[model samples]
Target: MSIAEKLSQMGVTLPDAPAPAANYVPSVRSGDLLFVSGQVSSGADGLIKGRLGADMSVEDGAAAARACAISLLAQVRAACDGDIDRLDRVVKLTGFVNCTPEFGDMPAVVNGASDFLVEVLGEAGRHSRSAVGANLPFGVAVEIEGIFRLR
Candidate 1:
């Protein structure tokens, strides 16, 4: 089934793509690949701000990161004219977490986004990933970017 249909089956309703904060496209299509811009934990309402392991728990950071993942998917569907079937599989995912000096839970925080992909795409979502701690993630708690191979 198409990804949009899959989303419907899963009862997932994508939000509108958030407006870009700077001079950059949200997603870029080159050949059969789409490179999604780094999406911070921001909603249509505003940015989800805080520092994981300091101002927030790992679960909170993970939830915020997953929200960003949803936003990323929204951008993908928007770019593809509301159809998500063009996606073949996820290629890679990179997540950056705003953290404290002693925070060693970057991977846990990024699991927020990682887990979402699997939930939505099943095996197609499996991909190499990198979760790094950052001083700040565009001033948000978490930020994630993804690469996908297109059908």
Candidate 2:
């Protein structure tokens, strides 16, 4: 099935690619690689913000991470000239979770994005990853960036 069909099967509708809040572009292509900028959790309900291990549960944080992944896909679609099918494979993902210093479930939280990608792209979604605790920008709960190989 096409990427759009897969997304539809998954009950996902890609939102408009968000404009950069800063001076940097949302995504850039170099050679066959596309580098997507970090995306924070901001869905239909607005930014998901809270410090994990303090006021947010792992499940909630994971949901925020998933939202960030959706945003990443939106950026990737835009980068591919509105054709996500042009994506060859997911190369890597760097996730940042806003949490207390004592929190140590970064990997699990990031798995939210990882799992969703694999679900949407199957084998093409498997990729190297890094999940770290951080005081993310705008005080968002989770932030994620991705690198993709373009067809």
Candidate 3:
């Protein structure tokens, strides 16, 4: 099935690619690899912001991570000139979580994005990843960047 079809089946509608919050571009094409900048946690309800292990639960952080994943796909679509299917596979993902110094479950939270991508793209979505805790900008719960290889 097409990526759009898969997304629809999962009750997801990719939002328009978000404009950059700073001067940097949202994504860049370097040969066959597309490097997507970190996407912050935000969705229909607005920015999912908070400090994990302080106020937010692991589940909520994961949801925020999922929001970042959705945004990453939107950026990928934009990079592909509106054709996401041109994408070949996910190469890597670097996830950052806003959390207390004591909080550890970064991997579990980032799984939200990884799981979603695999659900949509199957084996192609599997990729190397790194999940780390940091004080993300705007206090957003999670931020994720990705590398994609295009056909």
Model 1 per-residue lDDT tens digits across residues 34-139: 9999888976568899997778999999998898788888888777877777778889989999988899999998888889888889999888999999876457
For model 3, how does the per-residue alpha-carbon lDDT over 1-151 read when each residue is reduced to its tens digit? 9888889989999999999999999999999999999999998988999999999999999999999999999999999889988888999999999999999999999999999999999999999999999989888999999999998
- Report, for every candidate in turn, its global Cα lDDT versus the true structure: 0.85, 0.94, 0.95
- Across 44-150, the per-residue lDDT of candidate 2 in tens digits comes to 98888988999999999999999999999999999988998998899999999999999999999999999999999999999999999999888899999999999
Top model number, lDDT: 3
Alpha-carbon error at 91 in model 3, in Å? 0.4
Off by over 4 Å in 2: none
lDDT of 3 at 76: 96
Ranking by lDDT: 3, 2, 1
Clashes per candidate, residues 3 or more apart or on different chains: 0, 0, 0
Instruction: Give candidate 1's total backbone clashes.
Output: 0
Ten-residue stretch with the least lDDT total in model 1: 135-144
